[model samples]
Target: MLRSLSLLALIAASPVVAEGARELSAHEHGVGELNIAVAGSDLVIELHAPGADIVGFEHAAESDADKAAVEAALAVLGDLSSVIALPAAAECSVSAAEAELHIEGAHEDHDDHDEHEAHGHDDHHDDHKEHDDHKDHDDHAHEDHKDHDAHDHDEHDHAEEAGGHSEFEASYTLTCAAPDQIETLDFAYFGQFENARELHVQIASDAGAQAFDVERDAAALDVKGLF
Candidate 1:
């Protein structure tokens, strides 16, 4: 099956794709997005949101508490009933669902930190050996060495400040016995996550394509006639 991003590319070919892309890229803290497509009895929905909206922060889930929060959010996103409510009359069941926290630049930042530590350790060892060999010269360079260490510490702080922020992505596939019976999609997401204030929705189906800005106050999408 196509991944949600690939599916997004497919939707991008449609007329409303530009607006959808713009909304997602804006990355407003309390805003989220949903892309829905219906074809026959198959329904696909992709959800995207800033990490802050789901987990209270956008940094990588490094600490145990942060990691736990990410897992909890993923669990909720993966469960269809927890995040969405479809028409019961449609007799729909989930076929597949996936959720992930995408930490931008995390791997690159991790690799850089590892490499810096290794090089720093080796350099320190080399300096120690040189000091033993040339005690007099090393004593004279002690002040310069302190200055270099201070510079390195400042650079490390800057690197930490540039740590990556995260976002959540979820995709779901459902099969309905009666496609035409689907009239509305009620989102329980706002109740699950109080931080989520708005959902920018785009839908494509047999009837046509349409867009909506669903707010926390009105969390349901009127999907009548889409099938």
Candidate 2:
């Protein structure tokens, strides 16, 4: 099995399609995928997985609670140096790092509904006022009810409105002083994401391409021939 893994890794290191530029998703929930490529002194890595795998849930973030989680995830993914350790001799620095998170239904009909509802609320603002001549009572209950209904609707929309799955993909690039000397790569992604148990990695470079698996407990991989 190790022999096959090495062979596949070598094969994957060769030039393929523009796929290396695109995000490649994983096949399962707890499993994630990482793709790394070396081009001269520049190294590009991409990680893709279900949103739940990275952030613990795939539903649209409606509450204030999810922002902290999102920021923490982005912080971890944004700093490649933190998640993956590199050789000091290589003198690698993350020139560019970014993360993209997508909720399956966040911007679809749900958004349209939100827009339509926004215009609706604007035109009906006066209807919410109820006046009693004797006591001059102002009833804002209808407006309050609409606000409550919208919240409920949003929660429901995120739950069942989307098709397929929600996933996040992050890309980070590194510039190395000695790119050739950087022969190995290590990841602490497992430590960052508690639910992610396994990682599938694809590697391609000037030398060749390879494919391999990295379990959480074993979080290191070789990139000897990457460039």
Candidate 3:
């Protein structure tokens, strides 16, 4: 009977040994979209913004256990705040969304490039014919070639500037996996003057499922009606 009791005690403690420290899911009010995901000791935060804005957040940890604690905390974040204090084992990824206007602009540019290339080929052929007709007038041919070179440089500059715009929409999706466990979280935030952003997060285990919502501040950043 003693041996049996000992075996039962060992079985009860097995789960605690298999599962490390519990961690919390938390949220804070802020000027932009903030998404987080954690698996075991790994945590990732994705920040979405327009025009390459800076992000900051203040994080506090009471103990090493807090490093692995699953408790959710909430606070308001500002431009200068440090978002979160992450453990050395944590990993993060950041990305910016392509602005719709910019994408349209790029497509228009590609079309313009096609048109320009066609026109350039035609002009090159015309220049060849004119060169043959005026073989003795090498100076005029040189001037025409210089003008064509300048036109090519102007087109290249316009293409480079259109590609360099920093304005963009931002969105993020994160995946976390543990032994026999996996979870995924996804969120997006668009910077509109008076719209609402929506966040949907989920966690799943063999035991059950959990869902949570990060509310949007209309006055902060809006992502509504942007299909």
Candidate 4:
């Protein structure tokens, strides 16, 4: 399967792909993406979106309700039997599943936080060196003015605490008995996630690769010969 970023780059070059990405990304709280790969008789689908689009809030879970919402969304995404409705002739069954939630309870949250902090520290160290060089050159005025942007430090901290526009990626792999019969995806995400009004879908298969734009009104995409 093509990597999601690579797929984005491949499809983004086209007018339709660019338009779809631009339109979907315009949503302050309404965009998401889906990557579908049909290899042999296996089907793999990945979905990603901003945390606010998934759980209704991008910040840390401060209440039981907040946590529950995130959990519920993840659960729905994990259930292959529900999030999609394949044609009866296809006979696709879930094989493996995984989801990444950078929110409070996720195991990856701690590691990601550590990496983020390290990156911030590296920037601070660089800034400190720059300030020292300026001091040696008698440029105290510039150094003093730099503090004006110091307020952004607080915002950055808040972002770290809230997971900053938190995003989730759910991956599902399925084994299909009748790959030839599979042509369309009845993605339930449109109905499932109201806040996520638009999606950009990319499909790669033996025939070739294509991109599709999904909106609230039209949640399904025609994928004839894609497999």
Model number with the top TM-score: 1
- Top-down lDDT ranking: 1, 2, 4, 3
TM-score of each: 0.64, 0.63, 0.21, 0.62
**Ordered list by TM-score, greatest first:** 1, 2, 4, 3
- What tens digits encode model 2's per-residue C-alpha lDDT throughout 148-205? 3465465446546544356666778888889777777777788788888888898888
Who is ahead in TM-score, 1 or 4?
1
The whole-model C-alpha lDDT of candidate 3 against the native structure comes to: 0.34
Pull out the clashing pairs in model 4.
51-166
In the range 138-180, model 1's lDDT, one tens digit per residue, is: 5534543444355445443433454544678888899999978
TM-score of 3: 0.21
Error in Å for residue 22 of model 3: 43
* Model 1 segments more than 4 A misplaced: 1-24, 105-163
In order, the Cα lDDT scores of the candidates are 0.72, 0.67, 0.34, 0.65
lDDT of 4 by residue, 4-85 (tens): 9888877767886544422112224687878889889998988777777777787755588975686677667767655567
Candidate of highest lDDT: 1
Report per-prediction Cα RMSD to one decimal: 16.0, 14.2, 24.7, 15.2
TM-score of 2: 0.63
C-alpha lDDT (0 to 100) for residue 173 of candidate 4: 91
